[model samples]
Structures are given as C-alpha cells and as structure tokens.
Target: MIRFVVKRLWNGALTLAALVTLTFFVMRLAPGGPFSKNRKLSPEVIANIEATYHLDEPLWMQFGRFVWGLLRLDLGPSTRFRDYSVGDIIASGLPYSLTIGFWAVIVATTVGIALGVAGALRRNGFTDYAAGTIGVIGIAIPIFVIGPVMQAVFALKLSWVPVGGWNDGWRSLILPVIVLSLPNIAYISRLTRTSMIETMRENYVRTARAKGIGEWRTIWRHTLKGTLLPVIAYLGPATAAIITGSILIETIFALPGIGRHFVDAALNRDYPLVMGITLLYGGLLILFNIATDLVRAWLDPRLRHDG
Candidate 1:
C-alpha cells in the first residue's frame, strides 16, 4: 500500500511538472501579448512594459524565472488586472466555487445513487424508466441550453429565485448547483445502475442469496461497495471540476467564481493568471485522481495488488 501511494504521488508530481512546462510555452508562443488589446501605445512604452514584466527576457529565462517563482509558491502579478496578483484573483473566487461544487456533489451522488439502485432493483418498472429519462435528459442537453431554460422558468416566470447574481444568498446557489450537478448525476446514476446489475449477477452474490441473507443485508453488505467503485472513480475528476468551477454555469448564473477567469485569462493573454489557474486545475485533478485510486484500493484489496 505504501508503494502504491508513493507511486501515485510520484506520477502526480511528474504530471504537474509537464502540465506547467507545456502551459508556460503554449501561452508564451501564442499569437498575442497581454497588451495587444490595450490602447495603442508607443514602441518605447510597450518595450518598457515588457521589460517590467520580463517579457523582454528570452523565453528560456522567462521559464526559469516562472519555475523559480512557482517553487516559492508565488503566482506573480496579473498583467490585465492592475495591482492584482494571479493568486489574489483565484483566492477571491475559490470560496464560491467550492461552496457550489460541494453541495452539487452531495446532491448528485446521494440522489443519483438512490435513483440508480431503484432502477436496477425494479428493472422494468416506472422507477427504472424515470431514472433512464433523467439520465437521457442530463446527457443529451448541453448546460448552456439547460441553464437558460431553467433561468427562464424558475427566475423569469416563477420568480422563485433571482435571475442571476450572488447577492441573494443561498437562493442564488440553487440554480447553479442544480445545473452543474445534473450531468454528473445522470452519469453516476447510469454507472451505478449498470454496476449494480452486473455485481448482482456475480457468483458471490448468488451464493449470498442461496445462503438466505436478507435482501437489505445482501445489498448493503455484499453489493453496494462493488457498485460504488466506478461511481467513486468518476467522482474524482467530476468533483475537482465542479468544485473548481463550471465555466458555463458560472457564466450563466453570473456567479463570482474562478471558472470565468480561466476563459478571460486565455483570451486576454494574462500569462501568470492563466498559468496559475491551469496549475491549480491540473493539481486538483491529479490530487483527486490519486485520492480516487487510494479509495478504490481500500475498498477492494484486489486494487492494491493491481496497483
């Protein structure tokens, strides 16, 4: 188990390093400078600005400086947002994203698992059909479409929640969380239903049944862990993504989250901001994936050996 965990950590470190290197170069080599959109400035002015930010330095030197700053946990200044460090921008937005993401995961996992178990148990019944329909709707409809339609009905028509803003408190979170969780819920339910059905057919499950274990005990003790394996695995990346922020959901709901900053950073060529967020996202993904692997190994000893 120690070897397994160490290996996973080592791999995550390597993945994060490569991510940083690639993102650094790609952003640098991309077509425009952060100042490209600024009001036309004199050549000397641009050169001075570039010098101040070290853009006037060679690419290799810039990369070295970035790495050095990164090692010291400094994200540096944001070019676009005057007086703001990349870290500051991210820090300000993380809480909102975390809150929405946390609740969404809870709602999605709890509801999805229940729906999936019901569907699997009832196979051809109404519960099964309803779950299937939800899965289809969640998967088939894009979030952009869903967000607007929901806002129209819930905010515009019903007036149950504000149209789009963070000032309304908890009521503001409802739409964004629901929208963000919908796809995940759909996916988890489908994965759980399939896994449950397959696990039930395994010989061990039949043996348990032949041994006359109660249905509830058989499901809770013998079946649930196996069914949850895939769901848990999927949750790693899903949780990281939603928690970090859903770009579309954040944009539609006008929520103050880091998700929009990612898009804006890329478009504005805010190198430090872009790199910071990318590293943040990449790091989260790696951490979550490692956590998922560890959890899987703990749940099923076979996975430890496999690792």
Candidate 2:
C-alpha cells in the first residue's frame, strides 16, 4: 500500500506538471496581451508595463520564472485585479466553492445510493420505475437550464429563497447546490443500480443467501461493499468537478467562487490568474483520483494484492 501510494503520488506530480506546462504555453500563444486595453497607450508605457511583469522576456525564460515561483507556492500577481495576487484571489473564493461542493456531494451520494438500492431490490416494480424516471429527468436537464428554472420557481415566483447572491445562510446555498448535484445524483444512481444488480447475482451473494442470512443483512454486509466500487471510482473525478464550482451555475446565481473568477480571467486575458486556477484544478483532480484508488484498494483486498 505504501509503495502504491508513493507511485501514484509521483504520477500525479508528473500529470500536474504536464497540465501546467500545456496551459501556460497555450495562454501565451492566444491572441491579446494581459495588458490589452480599449484605450491605446504610449509605446514607452506599454514597454514599461511588459517589462514590469516580465512579459518582455523570452517565452522560455518567462515559463522558467513561473515554474520557479510555483516551486515556492507563489502564483504571482493578477493582471486585471491590481490589488490582489493570484493566490489571494483563490484563497478568498475557495472556501465558498468547497462548502457548497462538500454539501452537494453528501446529499447526492446519500440520496443516490438509497434510490439505487431501492430500485435494484425491487427490480421491475413501481419504485424501480419511479427511480429510473427521476434519474432520466435529472440527467436530461443541463445545469444552465435547471439553475434559472429553479431560481425562478423557488426564489422569484415562490419567494422562498433569495433570487441570487451568496450572502444569505443556507437558503443561498440550496439552489446552486441542487443544480450542481442533480446530474451527479442521476449518474451515481444508475451506476449503483447496475452494479448492485450484477453483484446480487454473483456466486458469493448466492452463497450468502443459501446460508439463510436475512435479505437486508446479506445486502448490507456482502453486496454493498462490492457494489460501491464503480461508484467510488466515478466519485474521484466528480468530486473535483463539484469542488471547482460550475461556471454557469456560479454566474447565474451571482456566487463569488473560483468558477466566476476563472471565467473573468479568461475573458480579460489575465494569464496569471487563469493559469493559477487551472493548475489548482489539475492538482485537485490528480489528488482526488489518487485518494479514490487508495480507498478502492482498502475496500477490496484484491486490488491491493494486484497492485
């Protein structure tokens, strides 16, 4: 297990490095400078600005400096937001993203699993059909559409929650979280139902039943562990997606999260800010996937032995 973890960590570092390098060069090659403005500036003023930000240097040299700063955890300055560094901006926004994502994951996972288990246990009954219909609807609707509709119904028309903004307490979080989680819940429920149904027919499950174990006990003890493997694997990437915040959802709801900053940075050609957020997101993806593998190995001893 220790060796496995070390290997995954090394691979994750390489993946992050590759992602950073690609994003850095791509952003530089794109049209327009970070300092581009509608108003024209003097050649002397432009030269000074470029020199101050090291944009006047060779591309390779700039990349080297950026990498060096990364080694010391410095993400450099924001070109558009004069008062804040890239790190400062991320620090301010990350907590809100994390909070919403965490709660959404919790709700999605719990409800999805329960619905899946119910559907699987009942097979072709009404409960199974209902669960399937709900999953289909959830998957069919995109977050952009869902977000506005939910805001209109729950916040605007009903006036139960605020229309938008992240200032309020739990009410502020509900719409965005629900919109973000709906797709995940649908996917997880389908995956879990399929895995559970297949696992129920496995030799081990049949043997447990033959031993006269109660249906619920057999399911809880023997079936659930193996059934969750696929769900666990999917969750690694899903966690990163949620935690990063949804660009459309954040924009619609007026939430001040990393996703909002990312959109603004890209549109404004804020290379430092864009690259910083990209790297942060890449790191989270790698780390979450590694954690997922470790957890899977722990749950199923066969995985550890194979590794």
Compute each candidate's TM-score over C-alphas.
0.96, 0.95
Go through the candidates in order and give each one's C-alpha lDDT: 0.93, 0.90
Task: Give per-residue CA lDDT, model 1, range 95-117, as digits (tens).
Answer: 99999999999999998999999
Please provide, for model 2 over 137-230, each residue's C-alpha lDDT reduced to its tens digit, 9 standing for 90 to 100.
8999888888899888999899989878877899999888888888888888899999999999999999999999899899999999989999
Give, for candidate 1, the lowest lDDT window spanning 10 residues. 298-307
Steric clash pairs (candidate 1) = none
Off by over 4 Å in 1: none
What TM-score, to 2 decimals, does candidate 2 have?
Answer: 0.95
Provide the lDDT at 270 for model 2.
92
